[model samples]
Target chain A: MITRFLSEVRTSFNPFSPLSKTARTFLAQLPPDARATGMLIKHTILPRTSTQKPLLFVKFKDGKELKLDLETMRSTEVMAEVDRHSRILARKEELSG
Target chain B: MPPRIRLQTRQLKVRIYHHQIPSQPCFYASLATATTPAPPIEQTIHSVSPIARFPPTQPPSHKPPEVRKSQLHREYQSLLKSSPLVLIFQHNNLRAVEWMGIRRELAIALRKVDAELAATGHKDLYADAIKIQIIQTGIFASALRVVEFYNPESTELPTQHPSNPATATLAHGLSRQAHEAASDRKKKLDLAPLLSGPVAVVSFPAVSPQHLKAALSILSPSAPNFPAPKRKANPSYHEPAVQNGIQKLMMLGARVDGKAFDQEGTKWVGGISGGLDGLRGQLVGMLQNVGAGVTNALEGASQSVYFTMEGRKYMMEEAEKGPEEKKGGEEAKPEGEEAKPE
Candidate 1:
C-alpha cells in the first residue's frame, strides 16, 4: 500500500511547483485526518492585477467554502496531505477493480 | 503791655501806645516760624538730588513666569511613546483584509487545482483539494475578523460566513472561543479601572484592514485608523445577509459592550484602553496570547502532517542514498580502470 501510494505521488503533478521550498516543507507536515473535511475554495473571476495574486476557493465535504493563498504552509501542507489520502483511495479502488 | 497802660490815660496815652506796638510780641513765636516749612520746601525746590524725592519705587522683581500644562502636548507625548507598537496593531484591519483577499485567491487556486486533478481521473488530487480548502477556510476566518467589530445600530454589515454556512459555523465557534479566551484573560487581569460607564468591548476581525476599519467605524465612526465604509445602505437586510454580514464583521472585527446590543445596527468592537497603562498592558498581553495561540495551532496542524508522510521518508532516503551513491561511484571507478587496463 505504501509503495503504491509513493508511486502515485511520484507520478502526480508536483504540488510544490506553485509553492516555495519553505511552503513545500510545511506542506509536507500535514496529518491525514486534517484532509477528511473542512476544505475551502477561493475564487477569482478575473486574472489578478500586478499588485494582487489569485486565491483559491475551496469547498469541503461538509459544504464549507474557504479562500486561501498558495504560498503558506497552511494551504500547501493540507494540499499535500490530501494528495496522499487521495492516492490511498485510488489504490483501494484499484484493488477493488 | 504799653497799649493797655495807655488806655487809662485816654488821648495822650493812645499815641504812646501806638509807637510801642511796633515791638515784637514774643521770642517763642519768632522761633516757631523759622523751622515750620524748611525741609519740605528745600526738598521740593531741589528735586534732582537723590535723597530729595520720595524713595524710588523698588525695581520690578524679575521673577520667572509660571509654566502651564497643555493637554495637546500631553497627548502628543503619549502618541510619540506608543506610536511604534500601536502602528503595527493599528493596521490590524488592513492586515485582515489583505489576508481575506489572499484567501479568496487561494480558494480559486485550489478549485482550479481540484478541477485539474479531477479531470486527470487522479484520486490523489482530492486530498490536495481538501487541504487547499481547509487553508482557504483559515484565511477566510482571518479575513472576516473586521466584521466582528461593526456597530449594528449605525450600519448593518453581514457575518463572515453568510455565503458558506459551514465555514461560518466554524468561524462562529472560533469567535466564541476567542471571546471566551478574551474574557478569561480579562478576568485574570484587573480591568475594572479601565472600563468606564457601561463597558463596551469591540472585537474587529483581523482578517483584513477594510473589515477591521468597518468594525472600528461602528465603534468610532471617524476612527483615524480606518477608512469609512463606502456603502451607505445597511448590510443586514436579509437573514443570510445579516448572518453573513455580522459574521463577516464579527469575523473581521467586533465591539464588546453591554450596550452593544442596544445600539441599532452597531456591533461592538472591543474596548479602547481607558488610558489605564496597566490595563492596556494586560490587554496587550492577552492579544499577544491570542495571536500566539493562532500561530501555534497553525504550526501544530502543519507539523503533524510533515512528520507523517514522505517528509520523514524523504529524510531517511536522503540519509541512506548519500553513502550508497558515493560507494557505488567508487566501486564503479575501479571496475572501469580494470576494464581499460585489460
Candidate 2:
C-alpha cells in the first residue's frame, strides 16, 4: 500500500508542466523584499480555480520556496514582514562589518 | 463636550511722563500718550485638537504587548555610539496609509544617499556607511513578530504567514505558543528584535526635508555641521482653503490624535523593545505540545472531533503525558522499552 501511494505521488508530481515551471521560474528569479513581487506573481500566474486564486510563491535566501496566498499578497501585513527582514539583513551586515 | 477657547493675550496700558518737578509731578505726565493708539485688545484663539487635550489611552497596567521604551533607546544609543551609526527610524502611531508613504520615501532617500556619495567623489567613504531601519510598533499585538521585510537592493517584499481569525486557537497558551514559534523563527534570522530595546520614535504625517536632513546627517558623519534648519513655513497657513480642507479631512476620521493630515509637526516619542528569545522558546514548546495533543485528539475522535477549548485542553494534557511516559520507560528500562510494541 505504501509503495502504491508513493507511486501515485510520484506520478502526480510534474515540474515540467507550464504552471509549475512558471511558478518555479518566478520564485527563483525575483529578488527578496520587493513591493511589486506579490502583485507581479499574482498577475503572472494563472489561477486554476474559478472561485479564487491559489497560493503564490517566494524564494528565501537559502533558495527555499515559501507559499503565500492572495490575501497575504494584498495585506498591509507585508510591511511588517518586510521591515523585520530589513532589520535582520542590516544586523547581518553589521555583524559581518 | 464643547471645546474650550482660551484668551491669548491681556490688554495693557502705558503712560509716558516727561521730566517733572516734585510738587508738579503730574505736570508733564503726557496727555501725549493719548496720541499713541491703544494696544489692540486682539485675542488670537489657537484651536487645539481635542486628542491633544486628553492623555493617550494607556494599555492595561498589567503588561502591554508592545516593546518597552527604555530598551529601544538603549539599542539606539549603542548603535549611535558605534564607529558608524545605525540610523533607525522607529515609527509608532502611524495609520496604515501614512506608513506606506513613509516607507516609499525612505527607499527613495536611500537611493539618493548612494547617488550623492558617489557624485561627491566619496566612493571610498561609501564603505563607512549608515544602516537605515524603520520599525513599526503600532497595530500589531506582538512587538517581536516581524510582519514584513524589505531590502533596498531587493526587488520584492517578503512576508510571513499572516495570522488568520479562523485558524486562531481560543486557548491563550496555544495561540501564544504558535506566535512565539513563528516569531522565534524570524528572530533567529535577526529579523525581529531579541528583546525590547530603546528606539528613536518619530511621528510625521508625511516625508519631508527634515527626514532627508536627518538621513544625510547620519549617512555622512564627517560632513560639515550647519545650524539647525529653520522650520518650513506652512503653505496652508497662507491658504485658508487648504487649512479648512485639512480640518475637514481630519474630522472625517482616522485622525492620529484628532489631528489628521498633520503635515506640519514631527516629534520623538519614547523608546520601545521586543520580547525575549527564551519566552519564544517556551511558547514554541507549548505550541508543539498543543499541536501533538490536537493531532492525537483528532485521530481518536473517529466519530467526531469537536474543536472546542475544553476538547483541545484535554488533548493537550493527553499529548503532554505521552512524551513523558515514553521518556520514563526508555530511561528506566531500555531493554523493556524496546520490547514493548504498539
Two-chain DockQ for each candidate model? 0.01, 0.01
CAPRI category for model 2:
incorrect
Tens-digit lDDT string for candidate 2 (B1-342) = 643775444523455678674785355665535566644443223222222322334212222335565344324333322322122222222333444443343345545645655676544322223333443332121322322211123322232223322322222211333234435544432212211121222222222233334433322222233122122622222233322211111100011221211111211110101112334676888999999999888777853545566778888997998789888877767666566752
Q: List residue ranges in candidate 2 displaced over 4 A.
A: A1-97, B1-83, B88-90, B124-342
lDDT of each: 0.33, 0.33
- In candidate 1 chain B, what residue range of length 10 has the lowest lDDT sum? B84-93
DockQ of candidate 2 compared with the true complex? 0.01
How does residue B306 of candidate 2 score in lDDT?
A: 51
Q: What number of clashing residue pairs does each candidate have, in the order they appear?
A: 123, 31
